[model samples]
Target: MKFFIRTFGCQMNLNESEIMAGLLINDGFEWTENPDEADIIIINSCSVREKAENKMYGAIGGYGKLKEKNKNLIIGIGGCSAEKERDALLDRFKKIDFVFGTRNVIDISNLVKRAMKGERFADFSDKLNEVNYSIPKRPFSKHHAWITIIYGCNKYCTYCIVPYTRGFEKSRPIDDIINEVEEYNKNGFKEITFLGQNVDSYGKDFGDKKPKLDLLIQKSAQFDSIKRIWFMTSYPSDITDSLIDTIAKEKKAAKYIHLPVQSGSNRILKSMNRRYTKEQFIDLVYKIQKEIPEVTISSDIITGFPSETEKDFEETVDLIKKCRFERINIAEYSPREGTVAHKYFEDNVPKHIKNKRLQYIMNLQKKINLEENEKYLGKTLSIIQEGKAGKNNTYMGRTINNKLIIFQSQEKLNGSFLKVKVNKVSPGPLYGEIIEIINNI
Candidate 1:
């Protein structure tokens, strides 16, 4: 049998899809790039935003057309959306044969087997399970991979659907994560980004045991082959001095931080169940900047929250100006079903207002990005080559601080590090001239 996995959403979902691919391949199924040619199809869905859900619907219709021609085709939906919308998905996509939640993803082979027997199955258990590290992964990039250090979220951010879909935070054992990174490093996947909805919350679920993110990262640095280590979506309240110290001490840990401040209004933040205030977030950013002079900061911001007034929106704008974030993911507040915001607040903000606010945020951020990046002009930076850009002789890479750099180079530099002297800087990638091939294999 042949299978095709269509994945959407965050790195976690993508990693899950890779795991499924490995599992399916182990069971004697070959992977097909063409969805129409596959005997089985899985849509690893996301429910983070209404936009993501809409895209999934559109994709399902597209795949449904192919299912008509191949009557033997087995279609399945997994990940966040399927975890939340299990049985309901069958009514929506009549062709969908099976539904499994995030936790049961490792048992996907059994689910496929049951579906092949003409039995429809839906599995959404609340119990947390340790992932089988023995499964081989067909990672999209051999040079870099997203490894989940922890699964799910403990923060019940009023607007977030993550806690409901992915359940509470369950951390993978620190040694397990370290061993995984070491194996990947040995296999020549040099860069690893440890993933979690909130990385700072790692090891908190370990009662009476010390939290392990800093320790795990420190140990990961011991592997000489691993070039870069990264973690994501750090809750501002949870970031610690130890983490900052580790980043300073370890050459492998990327000197960048992504701290999400959902809203700048103190009132909106309180309503959103976000622990930090606007002042506190500013202080945190300042603290990080003071500690790590070379660090680049990115953030997540939501505009047009239910309680946001013109004054509130302006405060958010002011915060953006103050922070001057290198980059930001700006989203218009959308009420998610099963979230506290959806239950308690009226969706009083008009669609037009939400969009306008989103535009305002993006416009301000674009200016900030350009201005901040311009400072790197004429400076030398060490970047890990990601891949070659489609543009002639242009190779794309990123600085250790996660700044994108595009430069002219002849040799294939992917999976290697090089020094570049920045000649031109923009809000996007900095154009540069290669000064040296720092390390090439």
Candidate 2:
């Protein structure tokens, strides 16, 4: 059988899709790049934003036309959106043959088998504290992979659908995570990003007396083959001094930190159920910079929320100016179903105003990014050659700070690190020429 999986949403969703693909391969299935050639089509979805859900519906509708040509093709929907409305989605999506939730993803093979036998299978969000087990052995690139450290969230941020759809926080046993990393390292994977809904809150569910994130990072660093360690989606409230200390101290840990400050306005933050204040977020940023000078800070910003006043918007603008984030993912607020923000706040922010606010944020960020890139001029930085950039012979790679660097090179140098001296800078990327090969190890 042939299968094609389309993934949406955050890194966690991507990791789940990888696991699902691995499971399918083990079940005597081949992966097809084209959806039309597949016996099974799975839409791994996301519901964090209404836009994501709309995209899924559109994709499903398009796939429905394909099903018309091949009636035997099995359609499956999994991940956050599927978990949010399982049986209802199955009923609405009559052509969908199988539906599985986030918790039951590892059961893809069993579900496919049952669906093949004419059974309409659906499993939504798992009950709280439930555990599903399967060790999926999926094929991966020899250079990089992702290892999930934890699942779900307890934060219940007002704007997020994760808590309702994915349930509360659950940390994978430390040994399990370490073993996975070891296996990847042994297989020649050079980089691993620890994934979670809220990575900083990892050990809280296990009743560990101390923070487990530090121990997990420290343990992963011990693997000699692991060249770079990175993790994401850190909640400010859960970030600790020890975690910063570890990242600063560990040689293997990537010098890039993505700590999301959803909003800078205290009122908007409280309304969004983000426990920390603007000052606290700034303090954390300062601490990370002080302790880890090479650390590149990235953030997420919501431009307009319900009832956001001019002052509130200005506060967010000021925060951006103050923080000077290395990269900013700016989004206009879109109220999601089952989220606290949707229930309590009116979605009254005018579309034009919200967009203008977003543009303002982006414009400021662009200026900051240009200024930061200027510092790299005449400096030699190590980069892993990702391959030719765009359609030209310009090779593309990234610095350890996760900054994108593009340079012209006649030689093919993919999957190896090169030392490049920056000769020029663009608004979006650094332009450099390779001076020498750094390390083949």
Candidate 3:
């Protein structure tokens, strides 16, 4: 049997797809790059935004058509959207053979086996506390891999569907995570990113015996083969001095933080159920910068929420100006079903206004990015070469701070460390020429 998996949404979803692929491969199924050539197909989905759900629906429609040519092809849906839609997906899309929830990834082999026997199934059972500590993973990237140290979210942000789709926060034991990191290290993986909906909330469920995100990073740093350690999507108030200190003290820890402040307006923040105020968020950013001076900070911003006034938008603009974020992912608010914002608030923000605000923030962030990139001009920086850029002899890589750099190279230097001197800078990426290849750090 041949299988193809299409992944959507965040890093967690991608990692789950990899795990599913590994499981299928171990169960005597061949992996196929083309959907038409596969005996089985799975759509790993996301429901964080309505747009994401729409894309998943469109993909389902397209893939459903493939069944006409091959009636025996088994179609499966997994991840957040599948978890949200459940059996309803099978009812709506008659071509779908099976559906599984976010927590049912480990049972994929069985799901496929059952589907092959002409038995339809929808496994939405709660397996939040179950930990697959040593499941094999076929990572898409050879040099870097995502390791889930924690699962789900408890924040219940008013505008997010994550809490409903992913269930409550459950953390993996530190020793198990470290063992996985060691496996990746032994297999020549250079970078390992610890993933979670709210990485800062890791180990909070364990009461007094809680092992914090800092401790997890500390343990992963013990692997000598791992060149970079990173984590993401931190809750603002949950960030501690210890976590900041760990990033600063650990030589392998990447100097990049993806701390999302959804909005800068106090009213919007409260409406969105974000626990931190604008003042508190600014203080946290400055603190992180003070400790890790070379750190690059990125954020997420919503353009127009329900009843968001011009003053609220201006406040967000002011916050961006003050913080000078190196990168900002700006999105126009789209109310999702089952979220507090959708249930309690009116989606009255005009589409044009929302788009206008989003564009303005995008332009502002591009300017800020250019300013940040300018600081590296004429400076030699270390980069882990990612791969070829397909233009002449150009190769692409990222600095320790997660800034993208495109440099000229004569050799395929993927997974190698090299020093590059930035000759030019753009809002998008740095342009440089390779200086010297470092054999070891």
| Candidate 3 lDDT | 0.89
lDDT by residue (1-441, candidate 2, tens digit) is 999999999888888888889888987899888999988899999998888999999988988889889988899999899988888887898889888888877778888888888888796635324332346656444566777778888888888899988877788888878888888878777788888888988888776545588888899988887888888878888889989889888888888888899888999999888999999999888888889867889999987789988899999988888888999998899999888888888999999999999998888899999998899889999888776687668788887778888988654467677888899986688988889986655
Candidate achieving higher lDDT, 1 or 2: 1
What candidate 1 gets wrong by more than 4 Å, as runs, is: 126-128, 391-393, 409-411
User: Largest TM-score belongs to which candidate?
Assistant: 3
Number of the top candidate by lDDT? 3
Better of 2 and 3 by TM-score: 3
Candidate 2 stretches greater than 4 Å from native: 125-134, 409-412
Candidate 2, residue 103: lDDT: 83
| Per-model TM-score versus the true fold | 0.96, 0.95, 0.97
> What digit string (tens of lDDT, one per residue) describes model 1 on residues 1-441?
999999999988998898889888888889999997999999999999999988888888888888779998998898888877879998877888888898878788889999999998787754345474566788888689888888888889999999999988899877778788888888988888988998878898889645568887888888877878999879998898899889888888898999998778999899899998999999988888888868989999888889688888888888888887888998888988989999999888898999999998888888888988888999998888788786788888898898999988865667777899999988788989889887643
Which lDDT value does model 1 have at 362? 86
Q: List ranges where model 3 is wrong by over 4 Å.
A: 128-130, 209-211
Residue 99 lDDT (model 1): 89
